[model samples]
Target: MLSVRDLWRRHRRKVFISVGVLGSGYLLYKLYGAHRRRLDALERELAIQRESEELMKVQLSQIMQAHFENIQTISDVMTLPHAMHNLSCRVAEELDLSQLLERLLQGKGQPSTLTQSEKLNLWERLKILSFTRMALSVWATTMLSLYTKVQVNILGRHLYIDTARRFESSSTTESGDLVDKEDQQKFLGTVDFLCQHGMPPLISDMEAATQEALKGKQLSHFFNSTALHETIMQILIIFMSQGSPHSWIKYVMPEDSATSRIDDPAPSDVTEFEQLMTEARAVLLSAEFGSILEICMKVVVNAVVEQMGAKFRGGSIAMGLPLARVLPQVAQMCPLLLEEPSKNQFIRIIKCIPEVEPFFTRLYANMPSAY
Candidate 1:
């Protein structure tokens, strides 16, 4: 039989092999724990990055939305010729200076009619009209400038977000990319057309790549849409009008004085925002497309001259060079003017005018379609 020492020596390799196996298992377990911790940390970091990215997207969306609102406002401003035209007639009916002057000069059989209050009221109206005229003069010129800039950058081209931002910044700050000459005539020429016939409100607020989108909309369709004006107000909300956080609470919960409303600054006046916007639009439109005073004066002059059988300022043109484009627009608005008997009488009156007779004859004489 083998002795104890001899058995120990022979089994030594087996003992060592078992110890090696245990050591390797412990090392693997530690490595696995470290790897799991690293994986968790990486996942957390990725989640944080995703949240930041989403926040950035939201901010970007708000900026883009504000930008588009401004563009629509500008476009709407350009298209207000028709609306302003109607507004002009209303103004004339309300404020007839001739009658007022007549009353003032002759005293209407007594000076009592033109009291201090009446004088103050007349002065206020005059001041308002004068201010409107001045504001429109400046604003309309700026709009023309902006239109030239937009067309040069993206009239026949696309409007990228960066380019649009440039436009917005340029409008506010008057510093950005330069506009090309190609845009100059394209935009300015349209101003004449707008003054003559007035534009229809745009169909969609989205910018179209081509001018075809703007060419042929019906004015009768968009006679009273308020979307354009409201869009301008939205722009005001984004840039100029600051909404008070607790102002609504005051309106809703008037008695609450937990901390006292006096602790906060007085609520900002939001109602004036609409007033400011409408006035701005009106002023710009009036300046750009001949003021109410001017249009009314033209009508009065046209009537007096037509009664004397004279041509109106040598046959003014628009829409394929029609003589006196304003008359057609005036006719469209007046049902009495559109009747066949009235139309024939008006034609005869025009035929008798010296400057108009030759132009009308030339217009119809060569064309097979003419009467």
Candidate 2:
């Protein structure tokens, strides 16, 4: 080493440079540590965001899956065969032909006051009435079943389309509101009409048709199987032809009960229900509905044919069966025809109707491909 002062002066520059280098190194270390901490924080934040995104994706998938299942269930349940079965059960309960026959047989008062011929005539009239009632019941039930099928089909198709549109747009709307509020009201209105008002006019028409078909005919002539079949067919034709689409709108959405709110301020406003009614009127006028009616007619005719044919083939007519035995047997068989095998046959016929098949095809085609 040199002398202390010389050494100090000579090395001062180097000392200063070394100290500056150390200070700069410490500052660089602090900056690197801060940047590293910031990067760690950023990575943690990104991980949380990714987890949140994945959770949302899972939840959305579940919701979409649920919506898909609901639509599938609706489609499965609203078929024509299912409708026939449901409506058949309802009609069976409502009409209760067996119970009706019993009541009719139990006269309002004792028959002690009436002469023997009067009793016979009354009995004959009761038989005709019962037969007519049975026929009318079948006709009304079938028509209503077809109508229910059509209504539900239309509703199902609408929902399918709506859900598809929503899915395509990535809508966050709840599936519960898929059916518009007004459309729901209109649907309920139709159910109300059918449950409350639809049957009465139909019953009245059936009664009128019965009277017209059997007017002036002798009781024996009326009770003959061939004659009864012809008469029933005629009555059905008359009943079917009685109402136009405009007239049916009254039945579908009755004027008295069309409004959802009793005191709705805008009574004349064209509500969604009114629009639905318009659509319903259009459906009623459509060729598909006409095809349905024709199919229903064929079903009734087929039932009558099978019943009459079976009776003849079984030699019930050839053996000179008593009217008492013959009539009850026929009446009992009428309801049975609506049971298993015949019901299945009718369903097949309905499914195959040329004009109606395309609707089913389109409805199924519109179903969503993804959940």
**Which candidate tops lDDT?**
2
Q: Candidate 1 on 305-341: residue-level lDDT in tens?
A: 2332232334322112221232232222222211232
Residues forming the 10-long window of minimal summed lDDT in candidate 2:
362-371
* lDDT of model 1 at position 65: 53
- How big is the positional error of residue 274 in model 2, measured in Å on the Cα after superposition? 4.8
TM-score of decoy 2: 0.58
> For each candidate, how many residue pairs have backbone atoms clashing (under 3 Å)?
1, 0
List residue ranges in candidate 1 displaced over 4 A.
1-8, 78-160, 163-330, 334-371
Tell me the spans in candidate 2 whose CA falls farther than 4 Å from its real position: 1-113, 172-176, 180-189, 222-226, 243-274, 311-326, 337-349, 352-355, 359-371
